[model samples]
Target: MPMDERTRAEVERAEAALVEHYPRLVRLAYLVLPPSMGRHRKVLTAHGLVQRALPWRAPRRPAGALPAQRGADPGAGYDLVRQRTVELALAYEERQRPAVLLPTVPFVWGLRLFPRAGGADELALDQALSAVPAAVRAALGLWQLEGLDADAARAVLVRAGVADPEAAQRAAGQVDRRTAGTAALLNSGEFDPCTVQARPTDLLRRRQRVRATAVLAAVLVAGTVAVAALPGGPPATGPVPTAAQQALDPARLLRTPHEQWAETSRVDFTAWPPRGRQAGDRQLLARALRVWAAPPPGTRIVAAADTSTRPPAAPPRLLYAGLIDNVMVVVLHDGERLVRYAEPEGATPTLHFARVDAADLTSAGGLVIGRGNGWLRYLIAPWVSDVAVRDLLAPEAPPHGLHLAPDGVTDRIPLPPADGVPCGHWPATQFRSSPRIDDRRSFLVTDLGDLAPVHLTYLPSPGAGGPGEATGTPALHSWARTACTLRSLRGTGVRAVNNWAYAQQDLPEGGGTATWVCNRADTWRGPGRAVVQFLPPATGPADPGKTAGRARGTAACSPFGRHVLGDVHWQAKSGKWYLLAAGSSEVAGIDVTGGVRAGAAAATLAVPAGPQAPVRVAGRLGDGRSLLALRP
Candidate 1:
């Protein structure tokens, strides 16, 4: 057909845009296209879409189209090509199979080409974006690739024929809330199609194909003869299976009603509300279930000790399904264990299973959804009304309010230091539901390298009833100097760690008062571990307290046992040495015999002594039972 002047002019403008901004235009299309389509096809299809965006004949612009974007070709050509590329990419996503509408030049037969593998952030964003709608994905591309805000991005979507631009923009906003620094990742060469790495496909298999052809033909003939010789041919088998099945359907997943959390007597994972932005997304849920049930070969599977990696027999209860830390995560509970299925963008997926056989209200309150860069985020229970983070090592500092999304996931908080490192601030997540400021039920939990965090509590005295939640400033300050000791309990399947401040006494020579606290780590498996530490009076932040004694496989600091006696040699600022011994409140008197002979009617006894003094400390309880000091 003969080209009119206007059509020729439009084509010439588009040609100029392509010539000047070919790489940027192709990258925009590449990001807009679905990542599920192999990178090879995405690279080829992205190039093809950009080329076809330039119409042979003049194209009609849609209504309400915005002017050309800033810092681009400014001739209206770049805008025309960009919108057309996004439209074609969206259309391609809706197609059944991969196809490039126009022939992509420079295509090779045997080699597969793909963009360079990106870092963890890029991979995570890719995986998360794959679960969103095509229009949402397109809006993200415009925002990142074209540097357009919500309004400008929506205008582009509307011009590209999106039915509901407002809804797309809102959905994109939700994604933006969870993901950070996406533009930088999207702009990196990780998504640049023009610059790609290429490798031959199945070289070994291709090389051996001809050599095995004759052998395969002979085997096929023998198998056909053998099948024919069987009695009544091959026995009847079950009907052929189809792609659709009830088990894999997302709608079939067992979901507890939102109200069940408050109405039910149970307070375990079964009562957790169905939370997360993508919870209702059937496609994402289906993919999650499929990957969990039959994870592809090479899929990474991690399981806690004694935890089974078997897939659930039935569709388990959905706890959460959404994008967290740039990755798509789906948490499920099968009444026995909690399973976490994580799919990082542009990378292999992973399955983590942790034993939660009998989770209690405290242990089931929250779970680590994502962790990275020395920070941890939690998917908290719906019943939780308030969230705050406190540094256990700096108990005097006020707790910082933590933000939570509508889905009940808390913002990332600083992680505690690892073992063998100098004592640093240990951050603990504080959760409470009651309205009262001094609610004794408000609990504190710290991550210990497990799916469920370890609960922290304090027992001020034996007469103070059972160990209560650590809420008051006194309890916080007591645990502050000893929280670093919990690092040794990491990955130990510990259910709770309690600090018992049993005795406080004045030091010798009027130095100052000191407190003796015992910490106990109760594991799910039976045995308990205890560490007795002597904390000097508030001096400075540099003091993290000293571990006086430790006992394993004992119930020393527990509610049932409730008796601990420890001694430590201290050096006062006057350069004088003294022996300090303390016992649980139940003790009537403590006697420091041997090297330093001294007796105190109270549970604490301090007497002057020498360094490395061989001291024998013993205590007599109210019931007249003798208690011996624990050895470190």
Candidate 2:
């Protein structure tokens, strides 16, 4: 999240004079050393170095280190927590025996402790960050954490210390020269004490990393084992099939080769691009997505696109794309990289489409995923716009059967019909975060206690139109949303109603008041934003085009009901469910047809911010498993 003025002031006050946030930096760096070797001393020593390096007041006696103090708080600015951690790590490396031997575990642990970091599950994510590549990291970090526009973040990074590539090369040469001087005598065989080294640490330090890794691994394993050993393997009430018509998989509809994959990422904000214009920049972004959509396993990219250019130039750099809304848009960057995307347009011209808000685009870590009820329209209009833009914009009409791809692509994988019972009792997992590499692309996500239902509605679109302009709402979308009555937690696993309200509220580092809510079972899949509530009932749809049977009543959601859900969960096509506790927060919500009533639906109860005011847990609302946390 971006730092507000007050917070920024505190961080600036703390960092401007020196480098990082505070003592936490020292603690983080301490983990890189051999644990048995006076960790406290090492941490304190790191603190001493920075203390001497940047004192409350620069000391007259230059060489001596001062005792570190912690009262000062930079009111705010930048990633205060992160800045503090980086300063500590970098400085600690400068003084430690094995400067390059950064144990990844300590870094991850430090991130988890303060301000919390995301995408820490693998090595590439961790490597993508650093204090040196300041520009790239700053621009991309905002892109990843706050989901800010890439161009904007790039500008901010440039304003900081980063400069263009010509300047960068000059700096690199100067660094080499300074290091090669006779005083810098690694080559002289004087056995320099401060040389950068390999990743592996001495046996003692290695042992420490080993210890932490083993502990974390074992803890996770034991937790899994414990769940498996839980009483009676989660009660036997299986999911009863709902007879809603299902959409044909997109693969079945398309005859050509179709493939997609999600890739993780990293950046270096300090690395600026070359001065002047660059090559094929228009294709840079479009191709970037394609690269990640299909990458070799165990490998990761350095930027959203190119990896060859380290320390890319200039902030506020444009992430170019070639196609958008049926028009070929090529971003121009006199000193920065640009982006362009295309869409279809006809006689009416693509100009009729509204420009996407700046907030909609992300450049740092890549596209963040979100979740909400929405429609998958099946439209069938004559081709009107530019074909290139049309294809990119999804202007073609949706064909019969469930699908998201072109006509005739087959994607059918099946489970018991709506007439049959599911293999388990829990509500099927619903998509939580929208479309991101880490989470499922669910059209409807709701918790009915232990059992959650995640339904994917295939909204038909007019053969020719843009995104948000699909044809018809799918059945699943309708089934997930039904009624506005402040009813009691209906099915099972529900305890009581606590508090509820709908507001355009902004929450803590993660959550916020919901943005959209889909109430009608018939509007499940569509072109607009959606906020789905419930899911298809056991009997399924009474009619031909829906999942919920006997659908009736105004659709609504209750903040007053007690919900028992973890942070994230999902149900695959196999009918098997997967759950993650707030692991992935950003996702594209399911598409709903149109606008939801603004603010909270008229309610009798008070709804404060989630996490406070007795917020409901993220869980299965359809299976009666809603959970609410009581703060201590």
Candidate 3:
């Protein structure tokens, strides 16, 4: 009854392969597994599936096995283990429960484990993977993580029991095509289950379960008496339940002293002192807490995407509580997020939540306290000495003074035009701090439909050096053509928007110099949007310029991604057309394909072409990094 020599060798080989590539196999399983299964379950299930995949009998060597990764030897045993692991994972997803009745090995009790949280890009990729079918997810992981080609991915899927490998591959390709560079995100820590962080599960629930049996008999005897005394048909609705009574107590709310801003090491929201006419109103504070814990029916709550609305676990620090324009307003900072609650004269209360974690000097400058009746008022920081409103489009004009009451609330200003709509005048709040203030710098900010306004800055052409203040004439002239473009970023939780003029080229026929600018809108989270525009020589009124290319949720124009490449079709005054292309300083060479085949050793390229010739472009940096043009 003992195994033969061949079977024993195969078992040993499979086990060796699994042990050698344990992290890779677990990551593969984690990516393919259904996300609906919580992170804790998925982590244990991935390990369990891989552990059981060791073959007792020799597996048939499949034709055209996928190429190995990270200098792997492409052994038959590794291929067998990978195929079996994928098969089991897909089977686990298809069935409501595990495929086998075995308990998860190395399971933990009363503890939940999850992979390290990643930035916005990783969060976005995880969400995208969750939307597709399990087979498609497997195909994507194989293609990205295992470095498999399309045909290889299809073959792997087919070997893993996919009914329609072609369909699954196509579905995965659709996602890949929609989002460029998403494949690289698979390598992030977000999908690696081997390296995880652990947190205790609901200990309160565990205690309740332990005591339930002892209290069962007493509850049964008391239930009869309580039921006989009850007289209601249906119990009236009450406030939402809270775990800790201290959270709901108004007196327990934390407060920072007015002088704390000067002594604090980190000059952020933590340093802001509580101020308002009703700062000491216990009844009003209690009502705000109650509503925040559990809002009545039909309450409107506007929170940023992916932000949680759960009430704070402990009493939050009070930032502001005031009556602004006949509306009762309360703002709280719970160390990570900023919560603003507003109740109009007779309207239902509305709550706003925005993540302010790791806030800096620029972000801590102001918070939008009240917005109603086509106006918005800001709760400026304590150190801001003077406030002014400037028309970003007309930088040559003088700034108008904005009145700030003793309470630090500025006079209401008109709301900017709706998102995506171009307007002639764009008003930005200009804050001037006293020179004695630490890290003092004058900057401009404008509301973006969130609690915090986004900082605006201008980076002059590469020769002019680093980013400059928006107040300067040169920076103002640079921002003139780019002001209107900021409208498109409305409603997005944008942290800052920087405008950089990366390249300038003189026209071939003495048509003067043209500029190429990259405008990047970075969010509080990591993901950002980038746009490249072509601006011709200015003559009369300011032109908005023509947009050449755009990319969303990319780091093309930020510090992390300091490369921008784009192309445009321009016709000189001589009535001759040319395909002009340029990139940031990093791009060493440029290549054009499709309608024309050409290459440039420098960052700039000019090719004679028809008015509407189809073309594509890509570039390579001096450091051996390759980048595609923003167009495609």
Candidate 4:
């Protein structure tokens, strides 16, 4: 059928308007929905909803009729469309249940139409908004983003099914409180409205066709399945294991080695370049044996070394070295059993042992010399104790190597010093080292008795750019002292503790002040411990405007592990002025100096106030490993 000129013009005008406002509508929809639904899904749903609400399909009036001939308010048409779209989206979501529901509006537009900005702050706002319920989010969007007043926002929320006006007002207040900073950022030109690009008409039509086909196909398949399942049959089986899962299965790998394992474990024999083909062959065989052993769950063999690479003067000993996950795993086959040792990358290694069986021995081919060797060598290595294995491996060093005594022997094996520092009173149980960063700093954490970790940070010294300097001895000693103090504090029944270096100031004669911060026991039912520091102003005329008795320092605490602290303010709750800090987990508070301290009792510290009016404060965690905090 041929369309009349008026009707055709109206259709074109509606499409042009939709195209112009498509991106804005999509952004609004995205903000309306929870972020858990993901950006892509939200954009698509929003586009669809908007398209469906277009007035092109409405019954046409007689020729020469006015815009209001059908009783439509031309000025308020957009609002009506938006409201209808939101309602449709909500209804679709309700009916879809487990499935992804289509939003009320519709338009064939690409997601690139909506570009995101605002960086980390924007991301934080999005995450915060996601935590809010959909209704609350809608109210916020309407009130803040849409610049609607309280009554207007309430009306929108009421239309969206929020029955209580008080609830709507409360939601608006919460949004205002939570997004105050974000709103400032948004208004500060951090985010510009995304420009809409014109998409090809053919591409848009093709997308619509594809979407329609997908919907029709889905409906047909659903109908067919419903008819076929009219009579119940046997229960469905669980999903089949994927190829990756099958390859990773320890049982399957033990029974029959997967072909993928060969590639994963292959090592270049040429890298060693043995003196003779015999040595090279031996090295190849050792590499093959190490590969055959395979890594435990969540680890992989990155590098391997063995006796084949040993010097001719060295005694005959079968050894294999591999990187398990990021940790180093070294295996040695003794006459009795196979000794397995593992160390986190750059950390002290730990030792274990496993029994060898005849079948296991044969699995390694000619590599087996001891009765308990062979494939059984790889299978039986059990982790012994949570201690460093480096000392056990290096017998010729200062500390004698750990000797494997007979069963029931009561000899204590000597272990090497961790990071050149004697363990002393603090024995290392487990150790972890993070990857070296910028070739300058690396962190090593040693799990001491009772899981108290002594964190060591290795950094380049003055005049050195790489990680070759060894000038951190003083820092290490300082950390050890702090760790000891924290250990004692823990002994006093303190829970949920962490320690960190808060402030450092260079002093005269190359000396410096290093302040440490730690969370005390949570006996007060508050969020966490509160530590406030005060430092006297620097002497001299460096800043002539500097006032006297002005104390400057940091205050910080954490209820759990390392968490980014949010806003801090003097909040008055129940007639008490509390120094409160908010984070993602919970808000922590400590009684301010001169605040009401009666009702409840817990250990309290007086924040130093030395005649400084309008006292300024800041909070800090710690730099690298200077401050240590324990995780439960």
- The lDDT values for all models are 0.78, 0.25, 0.79, 0.34
- lDDT string, candidate 4, 1-632, tens digits: 12333343344445555666665455555566544333334555666666665654545767897663322333244455556455545443322322333322343453323334344345445545645566666666666666778887677666866667567567656666744464464443223323333323334334545866997898787896766784577776754754333432323312112222223322111111111122223343343333323322222111111111111121112344443234444344432233444555543333333222221111121111111111111111111211121221111222222332221111232222322133343321122111221222322232211111222232212222222211134333333333333332221112123323332323222323322233222221133333322121223211111111111112234323333222122212233333322221111222232322221121112222223223322222233121211111
The weakest ten consecutive residues by lDDT in model 2 span 380-389
lDDT measured at residue 601 in model 2 versus the true structure, 0 to 100: 18
TM-score for each of the candidates: 0.58, 0.21, 0.63, 0.35
**Of the candidates shown, which would achieve the greatest lDDT relative to the real structure?**
3
All models, RMSD in angstroms: 16.5, 25.5, 14.6, 22.0
User: What tens-digit string does per-residue lDDT give for candidate 1 at 417-496?
Assistant: 85335666889999886332224267899998777888898888778988888878878887777887777676656778
Compared with the true structure, the alpha-carbon lDDT of candidate 4 equals 0.34
lDDT of 2 at 576: 44
lDDT of 3 by residue, 1-632 (tens): 12343344455666788999999999999999877565777899899888877755644445685532333343756776898888888986634345372677867998878899776557556656766889989998898888888887888898877999898888888777655576677877888899999987656545555666657877797887867875865874644544445777888889999987776668788889999999999888888887777666335566654466666778899999989888899999888889998888777787888878888766888999988755799998887878888887787888889998889999987777642235777888889865656556788889877898888888877656655667778677777778887766665678888888888877667778888899988888778899999888876435677888999888787777788898998898889998889899888999999998899998888888777899988998999988888883
Poorly placed runs, candidate 3 (over 4 Å)? 1-243, 420-422, 462-468
- Tens digits of lDDT, candidate 2, 318-423: 2223332233332212122222212224311111001111111111111101111221111110111111101101112222233322321112212211111222
Better of 1 and 4 by TM-score: 1
Best by TM-score: 3
lDDT against true structure, model 3: 0.79
